[model samples]
Target: MSSFTYHSLPGFGEQCCEEYGFSDACIIGDRIIVTGQTGMNPITLQTSADIGEQVAQAFENINNLIVHALGKEGHPAHHEGKSGWEHVVKLHAYFVGLSSIRDQARALMVRSIKQWCPNHQPLFTMVGIESLPFPEHHVELEVFVQARMVRFVTNESAS
Candidate 1:
């Protein structure tokens, strides 16, 4: 029944979500879900045309969101493993031109995953799409996080 409010990125506000009716990130207990992220820069609010860089930036954006959700509020801190990137347990990747760029995309994703989780690999599903919501965005990543959920129960409740 307990849930954390959505943590939206910059440039996305009430109007944007009201139109789309979606939030960038939401957390329920320990589980977190982040909307597909593009290579948009949080500061500049721009997406790179380069696919490789776009993939990297998209992952970076996911990392930023994880840190915001897992770490202490108002303070920058690394998550349990690999600076908050490990919290990302699963990913759904969308590519604009899959047939032409599958190899490049796979390579970059593998390299990035290694850097994030050296000991384990998160399950990934890559999909080819004609286009993305944002025209300039070449790659979009949907992130899912599952952490240990703990609830405090008083003696009365336990009894």
Candidate 2:
């Protein structure tokens, strides 16, 4: 059986299931799966009004979760210095006021992706919805990535 690990992000508590019925991230074998992440402040645990800021934070949180999971398994934190697998194979960006701020949100998201995944590029879809699952949330992002596992070794270490 492959070993699977669960990681609850710093800002998100262990009670994710009780509240959201989902874990922040889950590892199955060498692959890691991350759920939808929003732009909520870690300290206050509240969503922000600025879409750009929120989008940036959401990416950061996803990266942190991926790193933490890989570290637990003795693997490198990033795949080619990018988070959420390889090039975010698939992405769904949801905005509360998508109609009004679609362009702005897309601009911010592209910038954030460039900052996070400089090498890998993934297919992305943007959607504007009337409301998100959470009322306070203005934007949410769902990403799917596939990355090859990397092992670290020292010159003196045995194969």
Candidate 3:
């Protein structure tokens, strides 16, 4: 049959599911392909002007997606060994005015990645963009993760 299975976490990417019919992430076999995440708060829908804040929020958003995809709670520090961000294998970050904030974004991203994936380094890509879906958003991050093990919920009702 088909390997693709799509999901949208409760508050994170539900709008896209309800309005646009796009899921936050898709699971194909052991891999989770997540949509690009912005700094905009899912509850407030507001994005911070500070690039650091935006970058931090974006990473948090990505982590939340990964956590939900793995069918686990969002807390407790870490999941069963090699879960959450630890499963991430690739990351692509899009930044507006990358030249202006390259150093700051680099430092922040590097620190976060090192903290999250201390044992392995995921392939990373950073590119410049003129604008994002929202004006206030300064950076967007998308991740590709390989789950060491996953319990797939075949239907939304089951999830």
Candidate 1: regions farther than 4 A off:
12-15, 18-21, 72-82, 149-159
Give the per-residue lDDT digits (tens) of candidate 1, residues 5-25. Answer: 687665642335777887777
The lDDT of each candidate is 0.75, 0.70, 0.81
Q: Point out the worst 10-residue segment of candidate 2 by lDDT.
A: 78-87
TM per candidate: 0.79, 0.77, 0.83
lDDT digits (tens) for residues 1-159 of candidate 3: 647878777775888799887998887766789999999887678788888888888888888778887674232333564447888889999999898888988898898888778877889999988999778888999999887634466688496
- Which numbered prediction scores highest in lDDT against the true structure? 3
lDDT of 2: 0.70
User: Using TM-score as the measure, which candidate wins?
Assistant: 3
Regions of model 2 farther than 4 Å from truth: 1-3, 18-21, 76-87, 149-159
> What is the clash count of model 3?
0
TM-score of 2: 0.77
Q: What is the lDDT of residue 104 in candidate 3?
A: 86
Q: For residue 156, give model 2's deviation from the true position in Å.
A: 37
Give the higher-lDDT candidate: 1 or 2.
Answer: 1
